[model samples]
Target chain A: MKSANIQLETLVCPSCTQKIDGALKSLDGIKEDTLKISFATSKVRFDFDEEAVRIEDIEKAINKVGFEVIKSRVK
Target chain B: MQRFIFRNKNKIALINGILIALAFIIRWTAGYMEIFTGLLVAASILGLIPIALQAYQALRVKVVSIDVLVTMAVGGAFAIRNFEESAIVTFLFLFGAYLEQRTLNKTRSAIKALTEMAPETAWKLMDDGEFEEIDIDDVDEGDTLLVKTGAKVPVDGRVLSGEGSINEASITGESIPVAKEAGSGVFAGTLLDNGTLQIVADRVGEDTTFGKIIELVEEAQESKSEAERFIDRFSKYYTPAILLVAILVFLFTRNVELAVTILVLGCPGALVIGVPVSNVAGIGNGASHGVLLKGSEVIRDFSRLDTMIFDKTGTLTQGKPSVAEVQSYGDGIDEARVFLASIERESDHPLALAVLDEIGETDYLEVTDTHVVKGGGITASVGGCRVIVGNQALMTEEGVPLSEQVREDMRRLERSGHSLVLTAVDGELKLLMGIRDPIRPGVADDLESLKKLGVKNLVMLSGDNQGTVDAISSELGLTRAYGHMLPEDKSAYVKDLIGQGEIVAFVGDGVNDSPSLALAHIGIAMGSGTEVAIETSDVVLMNSDFSRLPHALGLVKATSRNMIQNIVIAVGVVLALLASLIFGEWMNMSIGMLVHEGSILVVILNGMRLLRYKLRPSYRLGSRE
Candidate 1:
């Protein structure tokens, strides 16, 4: 399993995190328990199975939800 | 084009606002109803694009956001042909979002400023022995980097050669330049004020101390507190509940305007944003001031601290022992000190180092017939004279007679918490020196400030002997003091205090203090302390400064209070808007959205006040020596 931290542009409202959270949860290979999207820091953290999905796919999912990804790190 | 509209939503908001004003003016002055209606329709459609787009995105994810409520209210008003109401509501929503984004960015500026200060480039030493500039990410551990005057130290490393004074404000929040020479350690992001240095990197990138500080602070600000979790849960059901209420009202009364107004007023914009702004601002302030509050939970616990326990060595007193007093018995005192320095040079005891340090400069002498007395002292012949350096027990063994005056001096030194080191030359008592770890300067004033901040009890626990503990405890005006406590004993005592209904915060440094640091209600570790202590503790005072203690307590108190104030402001504004709508005739969709956005700005400005927080001068610990 690989963990990733994704930074987003500033989130204006707390409810907006729900949109990104729903987007990431719907993707394949992402761990449900490790998905944490913080509206305060405009960052998302989650663990995913590397064999099933790549980080770029996860960023695409977030982008499709109308939020821009500033940067991401996977370890 | 969609992306451009999203990026320039504020510009569109300005155009919509002008259209609304022009329509209002035309309707009142020229009575041109067709042009007024045309302008109103254009303005409403222009403002609705961004909000409806956001609402569509939210709905695609199965989420009910504030944008959804605004979109529904504006669409309902348009369906009912309330052109004035529709135009004003959409304009208010867009303009409100613009103001909110601007002020919310200000609350987050503390972390933004820190990220901007991160060093980006480094001068790397090539294999050819020439220096070349490189990106910071490209530099690796064990690589040698050359740092010039006014350039940031690109990595955490030990100085291999050269010298300079570096400003370490980014790491420790102190702007004063600290001198560095060969073998001195430097951290990333510190600027070399003058001179040059060649350093071999020990830690690079995120492994550097500055990087860890940024990461820790970012995580801290993002972590939720108890109140925040409650608010999050509250809003989860709140928006949907407001929608249900709006639907029921329209079904029961057949009143479209009343239902739309309820939907607009029920947007919990202020309540959703209030607590987080305070949390982020508080943690940011702590990061900038060399104090790390770890998370909102730690801030809550620290502000309620009732008793603070301190380890004697390092936390309260200088850990290094030094000579405190020197008394000589007879003539040839200079010769006696020379013999003392010579004998101490050969011994590895801590007291021996203090003796040699106090003597400063001395001549070396050939020694003969050296004997190490078990737990007594060292006995040797120096420069053809018998020299005995040890405690009084060794004096008794050597039959060195002690006069009544000498005995009185010994008692006085012991009472003052000094360990005695008596030196005798040729069986005559020659010199008596007192050694102890001196209490850190200005600690008394810092303790006073802690008291002023409402810490009910101040206690100290130490492994040192009781006399020294008593002396220090009395001098600093601590309420209680304990001596000869092992690590387990200290943690057990902290447990006992917590069991008895007292909130405890333990301040300590060193490996032995790690257990207590973990067991206390709030563990505050000095930044320069061991890795285990820093990792186990909840709060860290960067630079190991004792003065930041009172400041840390004061800051948390102010932060938690600010959070409550924001919560009240948010909830109160929501209640006022609702009650005014039901009890009075003046409430409408535009007025509701305007007040909702105004309340958010108010809470954000309240949270931002923490960024300028400083311990007042009267409560600040006096200047250090």
Candidate 2:
């Protein structure tokens, strides 16, 4: 298992976090329970299986939900 | 076109506003209903693009957001042929969102400001023994770096060789320049004021102290409190509930305009944003001022603290013992000090260092037969004369007889809480040195400020003897004092106080105090304390400064109060808008959107007040001396 933190541009509204969370949860490799998205800081943190998914795929999923991903780091 | 609409949202809002004004002008001046209606339709369509796109994205995720409510309201107004209301409402919604976005970014500026201060490059030593500039990320532990005057220290390291003053305002929020020399530590992001330093990096990248501070503060601002969590849950069910109420109103009264107006007023935007803004601004204010309130929950708990427990040695006193009083018993006092310094120079005890420090510039005499006592002082023969340097029991064991005046002096020093060091030369009392740890300067005034901030009980707990504890406690006017307290005893006492319905905050700067720090209602650590204590603490006073304590308390109290005030403003405005829509005649779709957005701005402006919070000057009343 690997963890990643994705920074996004400033989120204007609180409910936008739900939209981002739903997009990330639908991916196969993500551990749904470990997902935390903070609207105040506009940061997304989650743990996923490396064998099942790559970080670029997670970024793509967020972009597909209409929010741009500024950067992503895998830890 | 979709990309253009997303990229130029502010532009679209501005153009939509122009169209609305032009339409009204045509209706009032020219009385051309056809051209005015055409302009209104154009404005509504232009303003609806971004709002409709956001609503569609939310719906794709199966969520009904405030954007969806406003979009549906605009569509319903168009269906009823209310072109003016539709155009005005969409323009107001778009303009309101633009303003909200701008002000919300200002609340997170603290994190942005800290990231800007992060050092980006270093001058590292190359293989040829010369220095080369490199990115900070490329620097690693054990890499030697050179720092010039007016340059930032690129990593946390020790000064291999240098003498200068460094401004550590970024690390400790104290802007005073500190003198640095060989073997002294320097943190990343601190500026060198005047000299050059060659330092070897002990920690690099994210492991540096500045890096940890930024990461901790970012996490602190992001973490939610109880009020925020409650609002998150409230808004989840609230937006959909408002939709249901709008549908019910439409079905009962067959009033489409009234139903759409209700949807516009019940967006819950301000209520969703109120608490988090207060938390973010409060945490941000604390970071820039050198106090680290770990999270929103810490802010809440710290504000309600009633009893504050202090560890005596490091928290209240300077933690370094020094010679406070001295007396000469007989002749050869200067010779006795030379013997004392000679014996103490061979020992590395803390008290020994204190005695040696006091007897500066003394001559070292050649001697032999140095014997160590288990719990007493050392006995050594110096310059053909036997010198007994220890406590009273050690003197007695060495067959040194004490005179009547010497006994009286011992009693007097002990009563005053001094750790007595007696030196006897050839069985005659020669010197008496009373050593004690002095209280930190301005601590009394800080404690008084804490009292004014409404801490009901100020207590001290220590491992020292009762007489010493009593003397220090009486001097500071503490409410209670406990002596000879082990770490577990301190934790147990804190637990007992909490059990009796007292909110406890423990302040300490030692490894042994970690347990008590963790068990208290609020754990405040000194910045210079051990990692264990800092890790277990909920609040950190950078630089171990006692003065920031009162400022921290005042800030938290003001922050929590600010949170409550924001919540009231948000909820009260929503209720007032809904109440007016139901019974009053002045309510409309355009007015509802305007007031809804205005309330969000008000709450944000209120939360921003924390950024300028300072402890009132009256709190420093006792600092004059």
Candidate 3:
């Protein structure tokens, strides 16, 4: 498992935050309890299983929810 | 093409807006045109695409969001052949989001400013005595680095040579430049306003104070306050409840238009975003003022605090004491000074430094059999002479005989707020040194300001003698003062205050005060305090300036009041819109959506007020001294 810090381009409203959070949680391999979506900073921090889903897949999932992913760092 | 479309969602919304505007113009000029109806349908469809996609994503995770409600409202309007209402609703929603995105980024600019202040490069001094430019991360501890004029200090270290004026606004939030010379400490992220200096790096990379402040502030902004958590929980039930009500309204009245209007009015957009925005702005304001309120909860608790307890040493008074007078009882006063300075050099007590400071630089004396008595003083043997230096209690324990004149002098000094250290040789009292630590400037005015801010109790606690603590307390006009308190006694006093139903804020700057600091309802650490104190504190005064305390309190009051104002506005708009829909005939789908979007903007603008909050000039009373 690896931790990822992803920055999203300006979450315009709290509803957009809910949409992105929902989309990311439904993706395969994301650790459900580790997900933290900060609407104030437009950043999401989570842990995921690399073997089950790649980092690119997570970004794709966020993009699919109609929000732009600004940058993502893995730790 | 897909990526381009995804990235330019705002531009797509803009184009959809233009289509709606064009459709309205055609209808006004050429009445009842079929092409105008067609254009309206096309604009609504273009706007609904993104909204529908967002709703679909939310549904995949089993969560229904505001986008879902918006999509339903637009689709329901189209089914009813209300092309104008459908086009206007979707366009307004899209445009409102674009405005919100831009404004929310402005609220987050404080953190952006802090991140940008981090120094990226350093001038590392090579072994060959030449400066080489390198990444800050490449610089190691103990490495010598050169900082030129108008450059940022790349690492936290002590100045080795040369001097300069450094603007430490990035670290302490104080705008004024401070003079720096050899042996003076410098921090990373501070700008060297002028001159040049060579420094030895003591702490590098993320270990620097600036790095810690950034990390802490980020974490604090991320943590939710009780009010925020309550709003989140309220929204969890609110959205579903709105859906249930809308469904029941549709089932009973068979009016799809009314049901869709209900859904649009009950979006909870303002209520959900109100609290978090206020918290972010409050934290941002604190960061700019050199006060770090750890989280939203601290602000809530601090604003409500009525009782403040302070530790006397290093907090109410300048912790530095100086020797006021040194009187020798016997011959060889020079020998007495050397013995006292030697033993004091081995001790870390502030009074010991005072004694050494009085007898300037002297030759080292061979000192052996040194022992420190806790809270009393030190005992040592220097050049085969038995020596004891400490307070009256230490002299009494050593069985030293004190003359009548010496006792009179000790009483007068203690009464005048001076701490006396006696040096006894061969079981006879020989030297009496009076040490005085003056009260810090501006303390009196700060106490007055706290009283004005509704602090009912201003108490001082000290381990010093009663006479000294009493004199200092009366000078500061404190409500109460306690002397000769140990660390545990101070903690117990705070606990007693908490038991009495008073919210207490304990302010201190030393390790000994940590227990009391932790026991208080709010722990405030001085910025120049020890590491443990800062870590244990809920709020840190970065420059250790007491004047900021009133400003911090004023901010807390403003933020809490601002949050309440937002809540009332959010809930009020929802109630007014629902009443207009059920009882009046003039309400339409587009007007409802516009009103909802306006309320959201109102609350956001209200929250933004804290970002530019001004501390009243009256609060600066104690700072000048």
Candidate 4:
């Protein structure tokens, strides 16, 4: 089995602008991509295998921790 | 009681009906043609409007509303020689509705307050610069506007160039004026308390912060609390049940006339007006306070929550990192001096800004070859001395070796509940500073009240590392702590707790707390500050204060209790009156009317307990599981 990590370029609450990093990192099979989240502009990428975790699963994982994974169109 | 009766038009309606009924009976007995004619005519004429209005409403609307039932009750009472009773019934019914309207109107002020949120007029550009005179919706983004002292900020934008104290209390609920320099974020609806700012509008209309609040509050589902829903369901059948009982009595007793009396008595007029009147009044009370219970459902759920878990950041702390402590390791340099020099030349992180703000002199340092390395720290040359200011990785990447003590020092700062910044001059570690978000005021006291309310265990969850979460949790005396969490991590933790058989509430600012907030038994959003938080929660605390948690819990408690009292009052008074009418023939029309009127009044006033009720300190946060 192979594993890959992708930085979530903009893992922040679109409303609060707080980083949604550790929250997404806390889920099983998902690992933090060691990237610094830029407030309002940057995303925190995560790396996981497609067979292991889907993007929707990753979103659900992010949601569980009290932070949001906003896809910032502005950025 | 005073607020409820006058605050809502319904109460005023019932009270007016009672007073006029007294006048009608007295004038009828006097029997002077001029006086009786005048009195009867006035009462009948007053009575006709409600009947016509209700009939029109019923024909226009599809449902068999209370208005239709009420209109029929009044007409039937009048047909059977109970003119005063009919007059009072119709008048009270209309009055009760009016009170409900008035109460709702006051509550709608939360939306009206939304209007005051942003400036009504905005600047429009012409061939000659720009002049202020148009609606906010008309003003597009990129329009330049001038905001003066005491003026509400016209739009959400960056300062083209100005400095001032912006009163964000309208949106942020921060009482003190926030000092806004150029580039500091300013929101529309915040008042420019000091200095002038020429801002370019970044967002307008529904996109503006104020517009979003109105949209969110309107979309809030103000469901009836649990206790009220129980009564509401019961009443749906209860009213018809009473009418059937009246019919059965007429069939068995073989007395049509008395059955008519029973029917008139069974109208359940007071019962019908009781609870909603209370609810409308209750909404008044909630608005006067900062808590906005979206619906009766939230109030009901709040009545039952025994355990609550709060997010530590933003909910309990300011969430903005400020420089807390400085430590130095080199000769000829103190902790503050190195921090000042390093941070001055450092990249723009929140920690750097905090340190720079404290030091004040950027002109003192000559920096060359400055660069902010991604995920690493800054590399620069300060005063012919090569300097590297950043986290540990920046130095490690630059081949700067650190002693074991420096690592220990960084660990100590992190354990103390702050992020640590490492600074090295000439490739040797020289400075370390701890940066942290301060605990919000009144947090402990609010938690203490939740304890009194029988909250079993207080849990602190954070995306920050375990060390930071543990330190804050222990400091706050919370029972459990989970750290190094990502957004998805919070929901899983909450689900785990719920799986363990606990009714839990998640209190957060609503931004990062979306999944957990949605999944919890209740989701409480920080008032109006953060958009997503307010948009996606059950309760909106108009003021983002930890102090409000206790008050919100208390309100739900009081409201739930009142709803029960109302249901009992509604059923008890009507059922008792039915028994009295059947068993006690001595009870005449006037006296029967009096008992009915009194019971309705009692139930109504009882419901009003939600209005002026005082909450005494009762429960404390009890630890369990």
Candidate 5:
């Protein structure tokens, strides 16, 4: 699994954080234990299997929850 | 449809806001005309689009969000033909979200600045003897890079040629530009103010100190404090409890409007966001000032520290000792000097450094079987002679008899607050060196400020002799001083202090001080210290400036106070609205929603105050030494 840090546009409140967190956690290739959604910094960090899912899919998940993904980097 | 809604969420909210304003004007001027009602219904549905879509998305993931509650309240109001109330509530909610996004972005600007400072390209030295711009990621370790004036140094490396002043503010948070010559270290993201230099890249990408600092700040911002975690759990149950209470109100009084008002008042918006916002802003403030507080918990713990235990050598003093006097006990003073220089060359202790500096440029001796006697000194076999260089205890342990003349000299040096480093050659007392590390400038004033800032028990822990420790302690006016302490002894002292219900903060900058540093309630490391000390510390003073210590403490205290104020404001606003709705009927749906949104802004603005908190100037002694 590769780690990815996704910076999202400013999260307005805790509810938006929960929605984004839930959306990303439900993805097939995301490592659930590594998922962290920071409302203060509006950053979502998680580990995922590249063969099973791509960063674009994760970005899509967040976008579906009404948040914009600003940038993402894989490490 | 989802993409369109997501892209134009703000515009939709703005349009809805205009429609609501139009509805309000028509109601005021036309006495609730049909056109006003039509505009109200249109604004309600328009604002509800994003909220309803967000609610649906949350439902798909099996989570109930604030949008879900707001959407329900809007839909129920629409079903009852309460067009004005529905329009105002939805418009207010969307407007609140817009303000929140703007303010939250301000709170996060510190990290944003850091992320933007990351250099994207580097001038890699090509094999064809020309510099080519390459992506930073493509610049590998050991690659030579050219850093010109006014360009960010793209990788952490050593200057190979040329000279320049580099501003390392991005890495160390120190704004002053430092001169860099051959063999001097430079980090990525620092700008070379002038002069061109070729650097051999040592650390690149995430491995650079700048990258690590960015990662650390991000992680620190993400980590929740105890108060934040408690609020998270509280909000988890509190939101559902509010829903249940709203349901109970509807069942008991048959007043759907009153029940919806209860839901609007009990959103927990301000309470949930209060603590984390304070944490992020406080950490950001510390980062900009060259202080790296590990996380919210560290700040919380540091704010409560009443007792500060200091490691004597590096923390309070300059940690740089100079050879004051070297007296040879035997006729072979020259021979002892060579052995001392040779043996000290193998060690990096401050006293060893002093010895090396005193005997500048000596021939190397074949020293073997070197070992460190913790807290005492070093043992080695040099030139086939068993030479032991250490303190008085090492001499006594080695059974080297101290002559009366040498003993008198040691007594004088000890009385004068000079640490004695004795050399014993083949069971004979050879030489005695007086090493003294001057107390750091501004320490007395820093300690005085710490006391003023509520540090009650200030103590100094040291492995030096009683005379030296006592002399320094008396000079600094510390509450207590413990001498002749080993690493474990220092840790035990810290544990003892903690056992007495005192929150101890240990400040040190040496390898031996790591145990005590880790044992204290808060470990503060001086930036110039060993890597072990830095890694073991919870807070790092990047410039090793003692004056910054008081400022760091003040920051923590301010942050804690800000957090409490936010909590009171958040909870107090909710209670006020709930009470008004339950008894007086003074707050309708729109009023309650307006007040709820206002409380969120209040708490957020309060947290942002920490970002601008200024530390009081440290008290300076009369002489300014």
Candidate 6:
């Protein structure tokens, strides 16, 4: 099972079409082994280990980066 | 949902819930009993179309929107033959969407508010030099425009003719009517107090000052609020997560009913809509009140701030000064007669004028070797006395004897909030004039208010000497102060604070303060500051009221709280609805829809309350000691 952390990739607000980068390189609880976040998804993608981190934690990490993690396809 | 959408976030949430209830009633009440009996259920399903469209958009963008979670919950109930539950789920989802949209619009209203500030038309100068009406945007650069009494200047430009007082309270936040003569600069949205003027337009359309303001606000609006950010990421994996859980439950228990119930309960419409809806409402509240918060991210960051810092000269003290006292003692002198004659005619400084105006502008011989120290005092030679005039440092550097009379007088002057200048004549003490920069009115009250409002630290930062900074800071009862900082140093200090995990905001109003302002968590630029400061700041305080700093923070904190509450409410409703489907079996489409819609209403209502935030409120007295 993948880490429960989800990531949504978006550009910085109105700066340009370029991808949003870091204001915070390390986010709270993002380092936990149960969660892994990547902002490669144009919208959002979540990979989760049911035991490691709750879905709420994943939402939190994405919010920290200034982008919303909306719905995603179930693979 | 229709009613909620029109009323804004809270209203939308309520309407969505109602529609969801109607859907559940139609789906379950029919129960294949009679086709005509399914009117409520049919309405609920029909209502889902709008939500589904948003969900589809979410998927196209590759992010699972909260709409999907809602849709799944309602659909699950439908599959389980719980028509009422299904309809309720969809209705609740719609309500959440409506609430979110409404709230978002409010938060993003900065541009909308600015656009409405300027009048729709300008007096265009036609070919024959006759004035004709034209759209404000159509007025071009270098075009001459006529402005009459009570008219907003169409563009940022210089007045070519006419003189009058202009009320610049809207754009630059200068409350006093600024006198505008030929060559006086004017901005796009200031009122002409009395006189008509011809202005040469420097910018037009999107390039105008007002246009730039609108663009800045719009740019800020596009950024997501903290609540929106969370829901955005949450919805991505949340939908699939719930679906997987339903699949897992079915596989483990071999009960399709339990699986469908889990799906119904787990749909996260309320959860998804809750946060963004609250953020939007908060944003709208800020805009309506002339506070422009860029986005939810700003709102979130503002709440965590630990230190509030300010630039002293303009941000805290009024940058105006006056001559306080004059003392003259020269042996070859009539005490006041000689020095007054020289200073009145020789110096061009405002301090000199104040002195000359104090006494008559007496005629005197031109002083030779006039020199000025930019941040310090001035000096000149006069009447063969070889006068050395400056602050105490300049007098002491010249080895002028400090007599007992002068010593007592200087010490007394020091105790008063005054700047002292010493004039030494031909190796003899001549004159001492004390001038002072006054503290702004109402500043002490604002600082006290900030302290009462739970600001952890209030610091005054300035490039002036420790004495000046300390004097003002101590008078204001501030705890932390940094004095004698160069422009770069100020910025570095603010940056260091931010790096140390202190969410710090720096307020300033000059080119000197620009770097530090940008480095702050929220750079609150004074409305009356130079243009450089206005461009660098994240938030512009339209008025130079020092109190607005605290108010802006209060607004931010309130907005952040509302957002968090909204998200929790949305999530809570989803969980409760899902549980109703599983263990209690209490959810039908109608009841589920009602609960969902009600939850949205609760969150939206919470967010809307931010509009009621006030600068001051009556307080109940504290316990007697």
The prediction achieving the highest DockQ against the true structure is 5
Please give the DockQ score of every candidate, comma-separated: 0.67, 0.65, 0.71, 0.01, 0.78, 0.03
Where is model 4 chain B poorest over a 10-residue stretch in terms of lDDT? B1-10
lDDT by residue (tens digit), candidate 5, B33-66: 8889899999999899988988899888877778
List the lowest-lDDT window of 10 residues for candidate 1 chain B.
Answer: B526-535
lDDT (C-alpha) at residue B21 in model 2: 94
What lDDT does each candidate get?
0.89, 0.88, 0.85, 0.63, 0.85, 0.63
lDDT of 2 by residue, B379-464 (tens): 88998899999999998888999999989998998988899999999999899999999999988888988999999999999999
Q: Chain A of candidate 4 scores what in TM-score?
A: 0.47
iRMSD (1 decimal) for each model = 1.3, 1.4, 1.9, 22.4, 1.3, 13.5
Best by TM-score: 1
Candidate 3 per-residue C-alpha lDDT over B34-94 given as tens digits, one digit per residue, 9 for 90 to 100 = 9899998999998888777777777776777888888888888888888888889888888
Better of 3 and 6 by TM-score: 3
Tens-digit lDDT track for model 1 on B175-248?
A: 79999999999999888999999999999987888788777888888888888888889999999999999999
Q: Which ten residues in a row have the lowest lDDT in candidate 5 chain A?
A: A12-21
Ranking by DockQ: 5, 3, 1, 2, 6, 4
Q: Mind giving the per-residue lDDT tens digits that candidate 4 earns over B531-565? A: 77666787778778666677778877877777677
Q: Please tell me the TM-score of chain B in candidate 1 relative to the true structure's chain B.
A: 0.94
Off by over 4 Å in 2: A49-57, B122-169, B172-187, B191-204, B399-404, B622-625
Candidate 2 has an interface RMSD (Å) of 1.4
| RMSD to the hidden true structure, all candidates | 2.5, 2.9, 5.1, 15.7, 5.8, 11.0
Error of 1 at B266 (Å): 1.4
